[model samples]
Target chain A: MKTVIIKYNAGNVSSVSFALERIGINALISENAEEIKSADKIIFPGVGEAGSAMNYLRQNKLDEVIHSLTQPILGICLGMQLMCNYSEEGKTNCLGIFDQNVKLFPLSELKVPQVGWNTITDLKTNLFSGIIENEYQYLVHSYYVELSAYTIAQTNYGISFSSALNKNNFYGVQFHPERSGAAGQKILENFIKL
Target chain B: MLSKRIISCLDIKDGRTVKGVNFENIIDAGDPVELAIAYAQQGIDELVFLDITASNEKRKILVDLVSRISRQVNIPFTVGGGISSVEDVSVLLNSGADKVSINSAAVKDPGLLKKMAGQFGSQCIVVAIDTKFENNDWWVYINGGQINTGIKAVDWAKKITELGAGEILLTSMNNDGTKKGFAVNITKQISEAVNIPVIASGGAGTMQHFKEIFISGKADAALAASIFHYKEIEVLELKKYLKNNNLEIRI
Candidate 1:
């Protein structure tokens, strides 16, 4: 199976590729629209500010290509944020794969960039197949998307939010499955089969 | 719920883990990669690789090694030591390290912290401060603790966050390797002063020490080496102890 990881100006491109290789699948990392459109699976991984990353996507015309892909696409971290209708990060618009708005965690007592392992409770999709309920997944980000019709899982970090979302062929996880160990490996395996 | 973290640190010499590989009489602490895998399975919150003597050439091999390890380990891993430039941090992060800790470089040129934080978001930049209590105050030390910067440790900790550091790795020179306990006074001081997470390092002996560091020290996480490296304490047991005490922990 041909797996292509979109290589925009985002972090975790190498991480996404390496994660796939660990699961016995060699994925191609490229910004080329053709490779992304032709792949059996497309992984969009980002750990960056949305404004600049969106600029790269629009300038390279990769945004249009991503919108046209029909294969199973997975977005991790900021990649998932950009798949939303809009984002508070840099006040940028996103791909509308999931009709939701991304906003910054409230200026509350909890820390920004909640970096560590958090449990993804209230599972609702096969993306978590072979993974136990309340299994911990690694996450690192400041902005978050609240629960919506597309949200398949939930997590509480100061406030309850959509830990993972699904809209037909497009799926997004706020957590880093690649960085999440055995349960994460299982999630990747399930995604590949999907 | 955001839980407290237990981080296991591995010190490397040249590209090898500083275990039996270098010392004939010492116990083979096992391969660093294998040890890291064990920690992940044991539910250690994070893993830190510190190449104490990392040189230019050694860093290249370390990047390649990190790529291999990250695929298997799957936990948030941080690489530190000899990271003096944006390129160094980029290479390490590109090799699959989630974060890169900068030490003396941040002291020599404070601008590096902003540059690193800008290039790769603040979440990836960890500023490690090696501090010692002297003259009734904790002062920052550089050049592996040989020279003191004379910068007050608490002042430096606050400055790091202002300069865009996402976390601070505070290591007390006096308590490091002593196995007594953490410098709760200093750790709590810095933890309270900074909004970002403070990882208390140095002088961790018992499970109670970890608990004290978490509660008294007010540290979001605690890092230790000899205890975990020598197999004196297990990550699971420590987490259990912290959990029994009603502390939120990942298991």
Candidate 2:
């Protein structure tokens, strides 16, 4: 199946393409509206600043393109953060897909970027089909989205936060499924089947 | 809960895994991709590939190696050695590396860190600091530990984080390949001084060495080469041991 990954001025876009390739699916990465709207699935992924990323999406009008897509869409990491109503990082507004807000991890003795494999529990969607609860997934983020009604998965680091968000046809995961091993692959594969 | 990471470091020379003492007297270990897959099956938390090769052509092969490993393994992959510019970082990341570690080139142009952080995001920029104890202070070394930059290791660690380094791969030259133990003093120095995660590399002889570094050094992660290269210590057993010691481990 053909998938279109919404491209922006962010890093790690290559990894998403490579991950799709490994799963035997060819993905087109583009910022063009027509390419994104016609795809079977649209994956919006970003690994850069929220303020500038929102600016890029707004300037290219990708923000509107993403909101109008009727097909399934997946937002990863900063892309997921951008789907929220707003973000404390860079004090920028987001696409408002999940009806939530993003905030920096509360100040504590813990490291800023939760950079490692951690267990995810309380799964609430088919995004984790065939995946056992408390299975570890790789994550690296300095900010987190508050637990919202759309939050399908939750993880704890100093405090519980939304690790995965699902609302209607749109799905967002704060962790990098491309970087996580078999468990992560399972989640992506499940998404493909969805 | 956050778990302390155990990183398997593969030193690459001509695309084959190699381990050297004090960056000399090197010996080949095995194929890079093969060993990488083996480590992943053994429950390795992360894998680091250091391109110790000097030639530009060899750097290309290193990139190729990174691409192959990224396709084969799903763990966090980091490569160091020869990333001098944002383009180099892009090539490696595009090739599937989650992070690119900067060493000599970063010291040569301190601005590279800031630029890379701005372009690729700080989480992907890993600053690898090679240090040696001298005159009651740790000094930064470059060029395979041959040239001393006189930049104190602790100060450089703090500076890189401020400049937008997401993590630090702190290697102690004095204890490297010695298997004595990690330079816990210097590790603790940098780990405490910086808010970002510090990966303790260098001497790792036994499971206790891993425990000591994580406990006393306050290191977020510990990396070892020959110990894992030769299968002298199994990664699963070590993780179990660390977990038994009341430390958080993925296993």
* TM accuracy, model 1: 0.95
lDDT (C-alpha, whole model) for all candidates: 0.87, 0.87
Candidate 1 residue B185 Cα shift, in angstroms, is 1.7
The alpha-carbon lDDT assigned to residue A40 of candidate 2 equals 87
The TM-score obtained by model 2 is 0.94
Interface RMSD of each: 1.4, 1.5
Q: What lDDT tens digits, residue by residue, belong to model 1 across residues A59-137? A: 9998899889889999999999999999998899988889999998864566677878788888877888778888988
Per residue, candidate 2 scores C-alpha lDDT tens digits across B8-122 of: 8888898877763222122323677777777787899999988878788777888888888887777889998878888899889877789889999889998988999888888
TM-score (0 to 1) for chain A, all models? 0.98, 0.98
Model 2 score (lDDT): 0.87
Native-vs-model 1 lDDT?
0.87
User: How high is the lDDT of residue B27 in model 2?
Assistant: 35
Share of native C-alpha contacts between chains A and B (below 8 angstroms) recovered by candidate 2: 0.65
